[model samples]
Target chain A: MHLLAAELNPLGHVMDRNIIGGPDALLMGDPHGTPIVTMHMLTLLLATGLLLWIMNLAAKAITTGPSSEGNDRYLTRGRMAQLIEVITLYLRDTVVKPVLGEKTNKYLPYLLTLFFFVLMNNLLGLVPLLDLQHIVGAFLGDSHFAVIGGTATGNLAVTGGLALIAFLVIQVHGLRELGLAGWAHHLLGGAPWYLAPIMVPVELLGMFIKPAALAIRLFANMMAGHTLMATLALFGLMALSGMESWIAGLGISVIAGAFAVAITFLELFVAFLQAFIFMFLTAVFIGQLSPHDHEHEHAAETAHA
Target chain B: MHILAAEGNPVAVQLLPLVTTVVVFGIAFFILSKNVWPRITKGLDDRDNKIRDEIKAAEESREQARAAQAEYESSLKEARQEAAEMISKAKNDAKAAADDLRQRNEQELADLKQRAQRDIQTAKQQAVTELHSEATALAASIAGKILQREISVQDQQRLVEESLRELQPLK
Candidate 1:
């Protein structure tokens, strides 16, 4: 039981790398000793860098190319550009616009950035960069190269930061669309004035709860997938280290590898799905604050156009 | 190997990543909204309008062409109708002219026959008178030879009148 708990919980490895200022207690002889910059942070930078490069390419293609149909225009220039367009257009026309109604165009930039950022971060997490880095490090005497792999989205700080921005956007949009008085009054549901006290406090808590949910949902999903993968992998390692029978180890590894493969595919799907869910929720919340009349007029205009 | 490296708390809200994420997101939002979306939207809008207008114009021209074809067909039918009318009118006029010419030709032939008959009758009377005079003169001369005498002008005239009465049956 002790051995199983140690292997499954794996708290020791966590403690060793969790150090802020001290040298890495295990494995790596990184000249910096302590990793001031953690693995998750590097992965976050990688996702951001990729987003910037891809978006910049898409932006340039849009601005310079002549306006025409086919693969020449800004959105249609390349397969990747077209893919970006498909996602953005689907979210805007199908998901975002119909909800936000009048202020859709105003809030579009923030929404697109959120969707792509989250999606990129999620996708980056799916790559076995960390596993590969670890394997290579094991071969190369646990060098600094192994530090390159981590699921940035799996980290709480990263998701929390994303949720904070989403929360701000939702609140700011409400305030901007409806003035201070209107915004304050929104918390007091449509009940009688006497109910304002209870409803306001409840609604305020609801507001904070929404973003927190977003953060936890993303963090938990990523963490769960990573944990499951690690646990299954640990079984194969245990069979090799604990058992004298090499054949048992080989059989265990084969089973573990197959299950891991299946989970990896599931994780990939979750990455895309979660990003979409986060963006979708944000858009829906923003839509709730606006007036119905504006929505009706916007729908009419859209229908006519 | 640890799947996740715990850093001073893997779950802690680190300042470095949070700030970096925020800044990166901010820059992305600004560039995309300002630089990318506007141009793409404009191109899409312009292309949509242009295609629609061109389609409308093409449809209008096609309708006009159809109208022109109908008009030409109608005019062609009218011209054929007029030509048929003209050809029939000319045929009627030609038939009427042929009838008139036949009538005039018949009248001229009848007048020529009448003039020739009058000339024959005059020639016949003059010849008959000449023959009668000659005969009477010859008879008078013979008689004169036998009787040794010539016939007088009153007697010749009487003979000519007698010969004209005899030729009336033949006329």
Candidate 2:
């Protein structure tokens, strides 16, 4: 079974050196050194930019007025109203308040933007015209390469960059809340001076652990979903290659297509959920540094104790 | 010669994944601190203000509703009390008026009865006086006829005895 698996699929090693190869765009001398402007990055950016433009237009159309039906501006159109209501409620209940608490009000706007931007980018990765490809003259067409870019967050470089930003924000807020002396004291687990040697390294490690985990979580979810779909697609291609029975090939192809579609829907939900989770976790981490968070620190204290 | 130099070589050389990680994380940190974080925070403040305003407005509306309800109840209670007072006042006025009428009528009836009784008593005395005067005049005329002139004491005594016998028969 292992030999058959290897023979049936040559690209079994999913995490290849392709990641370290910088982006193909850079390789082709596109001169756009935007860190990871690879195929996935390009598609992700385009999708996100397009989604943002659409959201902007929707936002502009929202004027304060009474409609012909005597309904308020917020309820003027069913679809637009429904979309706005869902986003607003999700941000307020799920993202902002849970992390920021009463001061959630203070951070709501930033978190909402973060949620939308990440969500839009993740969702765009799941699109089709955004991703179909063709072959041309002994080589896969350049257009095909352009279309084949998959999930953005699936790339370690991208998710790591985002996590790094969150890390900076958490530290900045922590220092701001504690000032220099208090911030130093907090690092020592808010413990006695004698325990400083042990707690300092632990706190330093704790700092990196949070952001590292964030990067991994986002990267893993996006990468795993895309890889599963691609593998299923390869199964159908393999059947076609091995057999003269067109019916069997067609049946495998249909099954592969169905699997891709089901996975795409799941990926879409994960895209939104992960973005929300990242933003929410960022808020929660920052909120820990707030003046009112002594109780949470107390738990950390007991653990250290 | 320069084209030949570029020939037979891959166009792109790959950077180490570690180097890529550093470069990406560095750029993201710079951009976030300088541009993204500020814009996001501004948007956040706006959203915060909006939520707070909504919450405050809701609380104020709820308080106003409570106050209005209290006022309405008080006014309703006052109106009911006023109605009860008015009814009681109406009853009292009616009773007072009835008592005044009854007392006036009773006083008038008593005065009328006294006047009527006095008139009846005076009328009876006047009738008795008139009967007495008439009877006296008749008796005097009869006595003058019975007693003829130029008679002595014996004749007067005989006449008095005759008068007595006639009076007895009449009684």
Candidate 3:
């Protein structure tokens, strides 16, 4: 059982492993000797850079300057650029705009960056780059070496950091929209002043919990999907170690490989799903504090009618 | 299963990655906000406005075309009405002129017939007078022959009167 545990340890694949020099390298270590230039960090940086390049291309394809002629100028150029434009418009017009209203434009960039960045990292994680690196490192007599490739969003620290930013943006927006007194009044949740004692603390705790939930939800989902993939892959090796039968091993490998393939496709869907959820929830939180003009207009129209 | 038995913290939140994410995200956000979003929003807006303007222009031109067609139809109707009026007026004038010409021709024929009748009456009167004179002269010659002497003026007059009475019945 212990042997199986060690052989099938899925965390080894999902966990952040060091790349380049060890902790002894310059600017590489904290006081506790945790390597700063770890696999997840590298992935995060790579995803960010990728996002920048993609968005720049999308921007160029989407925009037609003044003095442009013909109806074709309105069309988004290239399939990839069109796809990006569609997604951006969907999120802006459907997801965020209805909630944020006039403030949708103000918050769109941050929301878009969050969604694409997380999605990129999630997609990159699904690639077999980490496994390839491991195989290459084994040949070089360095089994633990990794240059890149891991789920950055799968990391608790990374998701927590994202949640932290979302929390800050939501709170800052709330403060700006409501001011100090109105913000406090919101904590009361439209209840009487006498209930402030119970409501204020609950509301305050709710604020922290909202972002915390966001972090855990994203991190657990990404980590579990990756761990499942690793586990299925290791099943074949485990079968070989046990029975020493070539047919048994091959059969288990084939079955496990098929399951792994299905999981990969599922993971692809989850990557986009998770990104959308994160952005949508963040927008919801922002909308909670800043009640938009559309809602008031609706109420006014209803009253008139 | 190994997750339960794994050594150290399985879900540890490291300081480095957390900090790196915030810093990196902030940089990305700053760059994209400055460069990308505005242009895309503007492009969408421009397309929408252009479509609206085109639809409005098309509608206006359609209205103008409808108005022009209506005006043309009205003028065509008026022209037809004017032509009908002119034909009716011409018909009336032609009829009136024909009636006047017929009346003038009848009046001229009557005047020519009356003049011929008057001329015939005068010719008859002149012929009667000549006959009477001839008869009287013949009677006077006969009387002179019987007596074998010249006749007087009174005797001649008496004989002419007697001859006129005798000739009256035969005239």
Best by TM-score: 3
Task: Compute the lDDT of residue B117 as modeled in candidate 1.
Answer: 99
Relative to the true structure, candidate 2 reaches a TM of 0.62
For model 1, the superposed segments whose C-alpha errors exceed 4 Å read A1-36, A59-64, A67-77, A143-145, A293-305, B1-10, B39-152
TM-scores, each model vs. reference: 0.78, 0.62, 0.79
Q: What is the per-residue lDDT of model 3 for residues A1-305, given as tens digits with 9 covering 90 to 100?
A: 66456547877778776553344233454445657487788888888888889888888888875466478788787998888888888998898988788898888888988898888888888987777877898899755456788899999999999999999999999999989998887887656899999988988997899899889889999999999999998888887777768898889999999999999999999999999988888888887788544355334323422
Worst 10 residues of 2 chain A by lDDT: A11-20
Top-scoring candidate (lDDT):
3
**Candidate 1 per-residue lDDT over residues A47-120, each given as its tens digit:** 87898788777655544355364434423567786677667668878888777877888887788788888889
Model 1 chain A weakest 10-residue run by lDDT: A10-19
lDDT, candidate 1, at A139: 84
lDDT of each: 0.72, 0.61, 0.82
Predicted structure 3, TM vs. truth: 0.79
lDDT of 2 at A162: 70
Kindly give the number of clashing pairs for every candidate.
5, 2, 0
The deviation in Å at residue A130 for candidate 3 is: 1.3
Tell me the docking grade of candidate 2.
incorrect
DockQ of 3: 0.43
